[model samples]
Target: MNYEFLRCDIENKVATVTISHSPGNKLNTQVYQEITQIMGELEANEHVNAIVITGEGEEAFVAGADINELADLDTVGMMDLTQITRTSYSKIENLNKPVIASINGEARGGGLELALSCDLRIASEYAQFAFPEINLGVIPGGGGTQRIQKVVGQGTAKELLYFGETIDAERAYQLQIVNKVVDQNELSSTAKEWARKLAQKAPVALRMMKLAVNTGANVDLESALTIEATSYDGSFATQDRKEGIAARLENRKPNFKGR
Candidate 1:
């Protein structure tokens, strides 16, 4: 389906969703709604193994929410928005397939938070990031508070959020906020390369791996271990597991059906 605020291209087992609203691609209410719908559609497609999210141009991934909308929002409006953003982002985070944020340009405020919700983030050398809510007399009301902390630790997350500062791609890499940094020209290529590799693996095992990391990171040691143990055993119970072993013995690559 065609979208007014986004561009979607599905090739092989990967779907690339590009936020395409303008020179800066600011995320508006319509954009947010459509993005959630597009992701929902992708999630239901068995042929889609991975998703890459990026912006349309090199200027900015998303400059943040449309300033006009944010200015007019009352307390009730804010609460409603919080629910929408939280639910949409959580759905993306909990999706069975992996999602990668291809940070091709500036990812400020909500944009950065959206990228943070993804399983992995890879940035172009020219990409920049910031949580500038403080600049507007507000703080990140999105999952930025919790998710950013997990990706970059409490200290850096606090400093960045408090200062409302922008960091270059290199600095983000040093902080481990992004998994990898590559040349601007190679950003999309690198993301697709990673997605392609992930698509070749057993889908069930990948889902379990994602579950182990996401759920295990939030609990006590005993609970985390319990989650990890279940994930390990769950992967072993898949039909693909037996195929993998048998294929190894037969000197062939296993064909996984996501069973």
Candidate 2:
């Protein structure tokens, strides 16, 4: 399907969604709508086993929300805006297939929030990450505060959000916000390499693993174990599991059809 604000390219079961609001690539309401629709299609596409998200230009993965559009909201309006943004971002996290962020350049405020929404983040050497909402007399309205806290811990999260500082890609990797950092020229290829590797794994097992990590975080110890048990059972029933073991026995690489 053709998308105006984003581009969708699927190759070998890995779908790459590129945010294309050029120049700074700011997220406006139209951009949000496109992102929501694109994610829905990627989730429903049976051939897509993994996904990568990035920006269109070298200047930004996303700079932030369109400040001109965002600066007019009142308290109630801001609340409503936050809810929609949260819902859209949660859709990516809860997708059955993994979604990776290949951050090509500057990611600030909502841009960083968008990156955090993905299951994994890979940044270009030239990428810059910041949460500058605090400097604007505001804070991250998307799931940024919550998700960043979860991944990088409360103390580190507080420092980044409160200070509104721009850190390099290497610094982000040290904070564990970015999983990998590569040369700007190699960023897309590297992210695709990782996504293709993920696509080669058992799809059912990958989904269950995502559920365990995402859902179990909020549960009690026993409840978490129960969640894991269900996930294990779900994967065990798939043909991929039988094939995985059979291939191991024969000392051959498993052919996973993502069934």
C-alpha lDDT score of every prediction, in listed order: 0.89, 0.91
In terms of lDDT, model 2 sits at 0.91
Which digits, one per residue and each the tens of the lDDT, describe model 1 over residues 18-75? 9988768887677778888899999889989999999988888777888888789899
Candidate 1 displacement at residue 243 in angstroms: 1.7
Clashing pairs in 1: none
> Which lDDT tens digits does candidate 2 get at residues 1-259?
5678888999999999988886788897778877888889888888999999999889999999998778897888778777778877888889999999999999999999999989999999999999998988987888888989998899999999899999999999998999999999999999999999999999999999999988999889899999999999999999999999999999999999777
- Model 2's TM-score against the true structure: 0.96
Off by over 4 Å in 1: none
> How many residue-pair clashes does candidate 1 contain?
0
Candidate 2: segments with Cα more than 4 A from true spot? none
lDDT at 227, model 1: 94
Report lDDT (Cα) of residue 110, candidate 1: 86
